[model samples]
Target: MSSREAINVISILGSDYSIKAPVGEEQTLLNATRMLNATLADTKRKYPTLIGDKLLVLAALNLCSQQLEMKQRHQEELDRYQEQVNATVDVISRTIGKN
Candidate 1:
């Protein structure tokens, strides 16, 4: 392990995992892991029978769904912004041609 690599122990779904990341990414990893743990904790509340691998899989699916939703929203926003930019550019081009 290099000196710049930070090893952090993050607990999720009652398990302790030592995850390594770049020193600068320590806080970001910690925050993401905490969110994952919280999602698993929510799953545990509704389904007490799920344990071990099943619970982990459920959490993964839930997180993936959330990620996909966010990406779609981001893409939609970007598309809207691009459309406005194109409209403004066209107006500028037309005004310049008239001059």
Candidate 2:
């Protein structure tokens, strides 16, 4: 590993994982582990009998669903902004043509 990279040990669902991250991004890696653990905990709470691989799979699915939802919302927002920009540009073009 280069001097700009560091190894960090992050715990997720009580398991410590050694991960290599860019020097300044160690905290980001830790934060990601924390998010995973939090999700696992929440999944466990909702399904008390879920254990081992099954619980992890459910948590993974939940996270993926959340990601997809966020991406859809983001795309919707971007489309709305693009439509507004297009309208503004058309208005500007019309105003310039009238001059």
Candidate 3:
């Protein structure tokens, strides 16, 4: 809705959607649509009888689950990095105190 936003059309689950995205985020929108479609395809293969809203819901759930797992993994990695930095700072402090 902002002045810098543009309408971009993306296809997912064999349907096209027109979304207003920030000018610089066209690729991100396209990428998200691609990811969703891929998830939808997988869900459809697993539940061939599902259609319409039910199929979309299942695919969205799968995507959400994957996103949560990735967020957890990313947080773990950040914690590990913080610990390493803290340890290095502690060592430096101790060495400086001895001087």
Q: What is the alpha-carbon RMSD of candidate 3 to the true structure?
A: 1.4
lDDT of each: 0.92, 0.92, 0.92
Kindly provide the TM-score of model 3 when superposed on the true structure, using C-alpha atoms: 0.91
Give per-residue lDDT, candidate 1, residue 92.
Answer: 100
The ten-residue window of minimal lDDT in model 3 covers 9-18
lDDT string for model 1 (1-99, tens) is: 999998999987667899999989999999999898888889899889999999989988999999999999999999999999999999999999999
Q: List clashing residue pairs in candidate 2.
A: none
Of the pair 1 and 3, which is ahead by lDDT?
1
**Against the hidden reference, what TM-scores do the models get?**
0.93, 0.94, 0.91
Clashing pairs in 1: none
lDDT of 3 at 77: 100
Cα lDDT for residue 61, model 2? 97
**Model 3, residue pairs in steric clash:** none
lDDT of 3 by residue, 1-99 (tens): 888999998877667888999989989988988888888888999999999999999999999999999999999999999999999999999999999
